[model samples]
Target: MWTVAGEIMGLWSRDIPEPNEVTFTTMIGALAQTDQFKEALELFRLMLRKRVPVDSVSLSSILGVCAKGERDIGLCHGLSCNAQGKQIHTMSIKLGFDRDLHLSNSLLDMYAKIGDMDSAEMVFVNLNQHSNVSWNIMIAGYGNRCNSEKAAEYLHRMQCDGYEPDDVTYINMLTACVKSGDVRIGRLIFDCMPSPNLASWNAILSVYNQIADHREAIELFRKMQFQCQHPDRTTLAIILSSCAELRLLEVGKEVHAAAQKFGFYDDVYVASSLINMYSKCGKMELCEHVFSKLPELDIVCWNSMLTGFSINALEQDALSLFKQMRSLGFFPSEFSFATIVSSCAKISSLFQGQLFHAQIIKDGFLDDIFVGSSLIEMYCKCGHVHGARCFFDLMPGKNTVTWNEMIHGYAQNGDGRSALCLYSDMISYGEKPDDITFVAVLTACSHSSLVDEGLEIFNAMLPKFGVVPKLDHYTSIIDCLSRAGRFHEVEVFLDTMPCKDDAVVWEVVLSSCRIHANVTLAKRAAEELYRLDPQNSASYVLLANTYSSLGRWDDARVVRDMMSDKKVLKYPGYSRSVCKNDTQMILENKQ
Candidate 1:
């Protein structure tokens, strides 16, 4: 159709000695509509060179073309189009069309779209009259820049100027809220709307999802249903994600039914989300059923299935599916490589992991941060810390996760000095240590018996690094002290720790006490654990074992009687090993 239109315009230019303003206007508008932006601008310039009087319609059409072209080229190369738009603006004022509301609004839109909000504001301030569109353009401009405060100010001004915000206004405000992650403000804005459209509902739902408030997202989804608002593809996908996060299988199945009813079950995003929801719920059969039923699968759906297998400890199956995916002509994305590499790590398949690493290098994803981090973790988990360090050093760029993985690799391999040195380098390189970094470092210190160094690091966590210690950090420090036979210090530290009531804290303390033969502290730790987590049999067993090891038969028997009275039966321990032929064998302790 565009080619036909261009041929006719060519014939007209050849046949007619001079095309009138209407002729040029019609041609330029047609080109702009078809996304022939360069052709549209060339024709507009031709009209000027022909000494033809450019009308308001022609100017508005050209401005629209410039705005769209600038946006298409992105902000980096938008200056040229911005220069042309300003020239058009100057020409509009000279032609006495500056006061024309439509022309003025077009100029405003062009400025805003080009990211020249200051010029947009200038054009807006000079306008004699304002429409809802004018106000919306300004609000949306600020919203796009993530300046939510300015958008709110304009929204208030629009209301004060006797222009009730339409659906567009509210939706734009919600978009700002989504960008800024202000759920409270987003909900207030949604509630203030007399009648929110489906887009509005989706916007607020996204806001809740962005901050990981999945429960609220689900609750809002229910409210949306009660209001009789039909769920679209996006609505279903968002709700499914919330269900996946909470592992709400029953709720997820209901959403699956809703998707079928709405005829959105085959939508790619919705299908992938269904796979993910089932996978997270530990329903591998249901996950497989969803995957097999998909008639057409995109990379996202395949990645979802691979992730399911990895999370369910079916690493061999995941690898087989990966091979099948490639054989079927689906190009693996970075996420695909990351998932399979993680699976290899889970099963300690160093040979396969190295093969994947070679493939990652060949496929040019070696620079990808996620893939790099996963490779590091895989090497570390497969008992190859040096291999992990080699990859860590070769990477051109590194984020906090990359740094943490290498440090954790060293820590897990019992190289405390190397982990601490890498941690110092991380700080020197300006990467802030998060809670996980501290856990790895403290664990390294505990395993190496660096008691004084561990104490110094723990004490500096709050004042120096601004990271308030959590339960895991406190537990790591306690274990470090307990390993060094500093029971007095451990007791004092436990008394002062904020998470003293947590079962995990007491459990660690009890385990350490039993190892160090502090029967009195072990008893106290056992009682705390019993109060915190009554169903756990480890506490009772650990306490009884402590008594037995110390030649106190009466105390051990008493503890065993208490356990029997409480009906806390200890389950037999078991070990799993993968055979050479890729099968699992479980060995249960009979004694």
Candidate 2:
């Protein structure tokens, strides 16, 4: 037959003179099979030129072309294939294949591949009859949009329509459940699989892994081992991730040995995970050993190294690694830029932040919300309120996080009025306030002695926004009242607060008592603080300070001697000053 012969001739090219429709269609299908999609599209074009009759088979082949084209064509190019696809659609209508179920399914898949769910859904609704493939494609479209409810509805409708769910159906269904965090449903599906493959097992474990059920996932891994199934890179990655979180050093070593035995250690993802595991375990030497033994470093490995340094408080090392990454011709991603900016923020290095900000603007990453948030926080940390506000205004997309950062920036700068104004503006802009928003505004009120405003916001929390006040909210209210010397009000408020075990609230009250020289209230607060956090040196230090403030030298000496006996240490605070001669001095003496 010409069909079987065309399959063989697919290996080589020859011009066939006066080929029939079957020969042309067979050749085109073979071209697509060999991944010569461009050639396939070209052949389709030639068929159109010769006015060859089109049918469901050729229409499906070209429709497959559109889907593959969207993927293979990067973001900037690939319009020509789409243009060709539009012409194909017109041809299909003329050829009476538009109503063909298989052809329509191909059209649906093509539209979904390119993120046009509207068009995909349109085709689905217009179908005269539904196949398992149709149901699966519809579910996949909703799953891609994270519409788990709609996906679930379709699964029910598919069963009602007497179409048995297949492997692809369950896989897409599980993906939807995973996105929705319906672990219960995920388990049910996994249990129903007649013969679950490795991918199925991995997907199930991934569900447990994402929700941070470390013990459950580890137990599942052990079960997999008992079944004598080999652990792939994903399995090892998941297990090592749990090992890092739980700090199971010995277990990590065993997993590392397993990875080595399976020869999966050389894979970049596994290696990056290994680096993260070792880094988080505080095994810097082991981490470096792993890095050094790597065949070569990739971008992910470099970012992991930088993240390791940043998390371990080695800001300088993180910055150094970032520079090295760039010098090695690795362009920084959003995560990389945010991490580096955080290092600058941690060190309060305005100069370095400005340097990176310049690069961000030049590279057009200034519009990146993550990087912009980091920049705003960094400017606030470095005492550049104007810079923080400028970035806040320039950010085109201002979410609740951006608003929170800007409000907190004002609060930290001691501009309570501006902070309140921002909060009002946030309300006007319809950005809902979260817990952090309340914390920032209340902190602003506390520092500025806006007791009335603080109390009003505190009262409005539950009624207006349905946000119940937490320990921070209560603590802020206490600070606000105590700072204004409303000692009686502080007592009533503390007694009425819903949360009683708040050591932080007591600590704030103790500090305020020290400021007002209220030895009685200070003693009560210190007692509660010591009871809550026995080892907190702040309680002892403030208690001793309270005694000294009352001119009770003997009592102060007694407190100091008690601290010495208990081995409590003071956490010193620092201040930096520049003298008249422009010489800088840093002091770390007392609070």
Candidate 3:
């Protein structure tokens, strides 16, 4: 029928036969499949003019067109509210399709796609009997809006209402749990499944993987295979993530073998995850092998390979691959930029980072907070904090991440005073500072030896900003006091901290004592640091150096003898400088 209609339309040329409602609807469906929505809309209008019967399928086809083609979220919402979906909705009601489960479900899904959750709920609430699919749609909609608790609530409510969820529904629920990182609830949901499929197993495994429960993820995967449910692409993705975090080379090989056995090695998502896993585990050769075997690549594939190279400090290779991706017309997402720019920062490739920054501006993503923050980080790391500041100031809107980046930039550049000032500015602008922001501000004071200022900011955070100091924040304050030669104050502060004395806090004071050549405090710090990081030879070496710097020759000799007795040799110091376009190792000391 479609072929005959197409032939007729082709033969008529400019004066094509006026298509009837059924013919127009079928043609619209075809156009929608090809994503030629504008022509479909015109055909629908002609059908209305000719008074042809507009059925539910025809109405839903137009709504699908609006949902797919509309880019503006607000405009899509307005369309769902007014003209776009209005006529079709009224037609559905008049034709009794509103009472039809399939038509109503499609309308709910369409509104959800357009971010018209209110309309979707209205449609959902009016349903005489809600299917598990409808319940899942509502849950997924809430998840899309970052309302994970509401999503979980809906899932619970669905169960309470006696709608047994299918695999799709469980996937949505598990996804919400993953997003919320509510492992306890996720486990409960997992336990309640009548007969869990491989996908559900994968979701459970993923929840564990996300929360750094690698041992649990591995155990779950073993249990999954024992149950004779073969791992699919999703299963492999989660398994590889666990291996990546744990760097369990031996177990990762087993997962790799499983991938080959299942023949999911060619799957792009699985392959990408595998590449990331191998790269993070420091198996670059295997990462390359996996990359070479994949016949087709997506943006994620490219990103994974680039990220792998960057993680291994293979900056040049990463850049070359990035260029290859661009030549293939694969536009880099913000994540790609973030990775490449961070690699640029690591290698001090300011020129390349700047070039990427220019490209970001040309692509009109300069205002995007993620991209802007990446640029800021790269600039600060390359000793161009002023450039970073300029970019940050020009950002149209500042998110918490962006603000954190700017504050960190100030801290890294030794402008801790400026960082503290920016913190004040951030609060004045009504933007609440997160824990990361407080860390940056406090670290700035520590670096610049602003003990009093650091104390004030640390105290103000709990009351004024309502940001309770974390371990890192407390450590930074202790370091600030130590840097100013206020060792007793640091010791007193440590005694009063709510959290346990982290090795990092002890290390901070120890290093500060070494810098100031405070022998008495250095001994106290050394004792505490050694108790915390017993295997760290740096602590021993640093304490010995403090004694040497203070001309306490006997004490330094005794410290060195103790190190020798323990078979803990000091790591040789080395320095580097870029001279005439060449990196030269200028110094080295051997035992």
lDDT of each: 0.89, 0.82, 0.81
Which residue ranges in model 1 land beyond 4 Å of their true spot? 1-95, 110-120, 145-149, 580-591
How well is each residue in 108-224 modelled by candidate 2, as lDDT tens digits?
Answer: 887766667787877889788889999999887777777778888999999998999988888888887788888888788878878666777787788888999888888877877
Candidate 3 lDDT by residue in tens digits, 1-591: 354434546664556565566777777888878876555665676567768888877887777776665553334333432356656777789887888777787777767766678998899999998898789888877766666788888888998999888888877777777877778877888888888987789789978977888999899899888988998888888888888888888888899999999898788898898898899999989988988898988899889998999989888789889999999899998888888888887777678889899998887787777888888998998889999889889899888999999899899989988898888899899899989998898889988878789888888888987778889988888888988898778878878888655778777878899988877777877788767777678778889899888888899889888878878766676655532113422232333
Better of 2 and 3 by lDDT: 2
Model 1 lDDT tens row, 420-450: 9999999999999989999999999999888
| TM-scores, all models, native as reference | 0.87, 0.76, 0.79
List the candidates ranked by lDDT, beginning with the highest.
Answer: 1, 2, 3
What does the lDDT read for residue 447 in candidate 1?
A: 91
Clashing pairs in 3: none
How much lDDT does candidate 1 score?
0.89
**Count of residue pairs whose backbone atoms collide, per candidate:** 0, 0, 0
**Which 10 consecutive positions of candidate 1 have the poorest summed lDDT?**
580-589
Candidate 2 off by > 4 Å:
1-51, 61-169, 461-468, 487-498, 518-524, 551-591
